[model samples]
Target chain A: MRPFTVHTGTAAPLRRSNVDTDQIIPARFCVRSTRSGHADSLFADWRDDPGFVLNRPGHRGATVLVAGNDFGIGSSREYAVWALQDYGFRAVIAPRYGDIFRENSLLNGLLTVTVPIEAVEEIWAAVEADPAEPVTVDLERLQVRCAGNVTAFDLDPDVRERLLHGLDAIAMTLREEELIVRYEASRHPALPTTR
Target chain B: MGSTLAQKVWDSHVVHRVATGSDLIYVDLHLLHEVNTPQAFDGLRAAGRGVRRPDLTLGTEDHNTPTIGIDRPIRDLDGRRQSELMRRNCAEFGIPLHRLGDPGQGIVHVIGPEQGLSRPGMTIVCCDSHTTTHGAFGALAFGIGASQVEHVLATQTLQLRRFKDLDITVTGRLPDGVTAKDLVLALIATIGTAGGQGHVIEYRGAAVADLSMESRMTLCNMSVEAGARAGMVAPDATTLAYLRGRPGVPQGAAWDAAVRGWTALRSDPDARFDTSVVIDGAALHPYVSWGTNPAQSVPIGGRVPAPADFADPEESAAARRALDYMALQPGTPMRDVPIDTVFVGSCTNSRIEDLRATADVLRGRRVADGLHMMIVAGSAAVRRQAVAEGLDRVFAEAGADFRAAAGCSMCAALNEDRLQPGQRAASTTNRNFEGRQGKGARTHIVSPPVAAATAIAGRLAAPADL
Candidate 1:
């Protein structure tokens, strides 16, 4: 994972709420033995239709996806985030994200930005007007700015730190191994014997 | 100041707190499956570690093996290799293994509760996220990754952080047609799929209190949908009754003492939560997902939402995209969405009760033409019970495909069974993600009755419609 700071790129409009992992990378894409090379498969069916936003010529190179509420719902597959990253998306702006997907995204260094529904709409309209127009998502300020407007929201500091540093939950836990060992030593005189 | 279920479980299991704010927590039960066990076994082997406690660890083959004809060797070489690897790993590590033909061979989640290995006030971990299903028995259960699996295998312990506190209380009696499946769908619809993130949800209130053990498992099985760490219902008479005389549960005087300890596991009356949501069960109706996500759902009688009406612009766009993917017209009644397939069975609703429910709908009826319907049981045990009860005959008579048991079948298209491209299906499985049933397969989440009814109509329909 890279440690580059995320700058919101062009906003690609995705109008639906609760965009599940399945749609992000259908299960067929998951059958591959290797995890890499899923970018082309992201939304393969939908992207084929010329009407799909991602397929629309104007939206080419859009890295920031502006989506509806409750995005990324369904299955705990980490592949969803992998596909999004492979597709060149650095940030997903929505009213909310599926919990597991969000955790996976943050762990993999994908930024999930949440803003008020009203602000999300404004951003959506701005992107729809000109799909090529860029939206700036500033991690330092915890805000999304585009079309002469800026909206700020809260992100759990722990998550922010993890994403900024490209650290996953396991890596974070491992980093504090010394503390964990000491804690274990103090809690039980002897580890409980398993049956 | 208030303790969440996660906090309560975390506190009780903490052996020591280190100055760096991490803790070493004891793990009570470790569930293993073929897909994730090989790597852990290799790690253990490389580390020169023997199985720390074989009795506490349990393994089963579900992900890689075919659901049908356990006697035959797996035709998929990759799958066969994975299964064989697990067998070898377990043998080398001295862990108990339940191969495809074993009586205990089933979904790890289902086998744990059925055999009474999943009990109240225990901490269980598995490589599968749905391990939260064990929490139905009042245990603290969650999924860990392959590395964590190896660590736990070697040490019988896990390092962890606590989650936030949240309680979703569904009060009052559920209406006659509503099952635990309906209740969970309603909850997901109301809270959105991400509502439970970073939290361990405790299902409380009168309605939850009234559910049976099987029903409780259905409720907790989908906790992953809500982004919850786990969902637990405190043990009561219903839980104890379900566990009594089970193959692995306590017997004699120990049973009495176990019950006493289990009884005290409930939240105190004064216990508070950082976040609380109250649901009136009476208002809920059978729900089905109209779009790609579980939260993008409506009541059986409701219509698909128009993208223009959305309050959020991004949501409006998403609605349009989902409408396109699902091939649904705006403002069309969701009940009118045509379905080409109906699937009943998965870890979510493939138990004996689920089979019985589908059978109730299929009895004396036939599935409509052009509709492909299949029933896959969660386990061989469930299949045998369904056979003994003649549910298979009813399913066959109704023209439904009564196939042998398999994991990730129609639910995920891991096997040969799948929805054709551009075809829509009504499934009882946990997810309706894009292509979850197959590449280009559109899934509409539905209950067993709805799935059966849709099978009969060749489109989405209610059970009463028949």
Candidate 2:
């Protein structure tokens, strides 16, 4: 996992609300042992239309995505986050996000910043007016900046600290393995029970 | 302050608490299936760590296994590989794998409670979203992502943030022909999808307490559809009776001790909740999703809602898009909407009771011409029970495809049981997300009786209409 602190990149504005994980990457494309190649399947169903924002010119290579409220609102699949990161998005700025999707993003090193809907709309307007404009997301400052407009965001301080240090969940969980073993032993106190 | 049931279970499971951070909570049972565990197992192998508690962990091949063909290899290549990987991983990790032909093999959520692994006062975590089904037994069960799955496999613990308590109180008796499915759908419709976000819902009041254990499971199972990770019903004599002689349940002295402990797991009379809502169960009709989301639903007999009915611009736009995708007219009655197929199995409603409910509606009647209806049992045990009761014969006689066993089937299009592009289906599955069944496929979520009646009519219909 890479530590995420500050990122500056072109922002892609997606004006759709309730953008579910199903549309992020369909279930048919979720197969495969490795997590790579998800970029090809990112928004695969919506890409056929030339007018779709991702397929339109000037949105290519954008690393920041500004989407409407309730983004990534279906399924517990982590593949949604994988596809976004694989598609070169370092961060997603939305008014709100699906709880599971937000957790997946944090665990996988993709930053998800939540702000007021008006703040999101401001970024959307700025990004839509000038596709080449770069947006900055600073975890240390807890703010998103674009075109002289800066809006503060809120993330749990613990999550921010972990993301800043590139600490993976498995390692953090393993640190408390002894305590877990003791707790388990206390709960089911018997011989090696085989089911 | 009297703690809620969720708080009781959560506090009891806390192994370690970090200052101003998440707590490390012990997982009493961890469930997994073919699709989600591959990456978790890979992570464990990469770390050179083995499963810490194989006895506490259980695996099953459901999402990718076929319901129709049990004697042969899975025809879908990806499905086969997933099932095979699950078998190998479980075997290597010393975790029990309920393989394709195993009696216990079924949808992870169904078999958990069926085998009594889902008991009161337990903290259960699974990789699938519908694991909330176990919460009906007074367990604190919820779903987690792949990384969390690996975390549990390695340490038998999960880092957690406790959720606020939301009590959904349903009063009054359910009207005839109305079921738990209708009640849950109505709740989701009233609250909208994200209404329960950040809260663990406890279904209470007269209506929820009156339901059977299976029906309670049905109600809790769809909590995820409403953005709630967990939903629980307090254990009582009903829950105890349902757990009496199941596979993993205790007996004699142990049974008495377990019952005593479970009896104390209910919320206090004066327990306070962050939020509470009351629903009139008697007023709920057979509900169905008319749009791409579970929250966008109407009663089976009601007319499709116009976009103008929504006051929010985002909701209105979503309604319009749903109308386009579902190919529905705003003012048309829901009964007039035709369906090409009907699916009668999923974790949401695919128990023995569900099959019997469908069979009751299908008996002495035939599926309408050009309509395809398939019924998959929730598990092999459910299948055997259905067959013994002659439900399979009734389905077969009614011209419905009666599958012998369990798997995800059409609930998720992980195998061959999928609808073609632009095809519409009346499904008992939870989600009606765009292309959830298949690409370009439209799903209208309904209950077992509604699904059966729709198949017979070749259109959306409730049991009363028959």
Local accuracy of candidate 2 as per-residue lDDT tens digits, B289-346 = 9999999998988999999999998899999999998999999999999899999999
Interface quality of candidate 1 as DockQ: 0.23
Top candidate by lDDT: 2
- Candidate 1 lDDT over A44-145, as tens digits, reads 767877888888778888888888777776655565777888899988899877655665676667788889888988988988988766799888788889
lDDT of each: 0.77, 0.88
Candidate 1 chain B, run of 10 with poorest lDDT: B15-24
Clashing pairs in 2: none
- Candidate 1 residue-wise lDDT at A147: 89
- Give the distance in Å from residue A62's predicted Cα in candidate 2 to where it truly belongs: 1.6
User: Candidate 2 — which residues are off by over 4 angstroms?
Assistant: A188-194
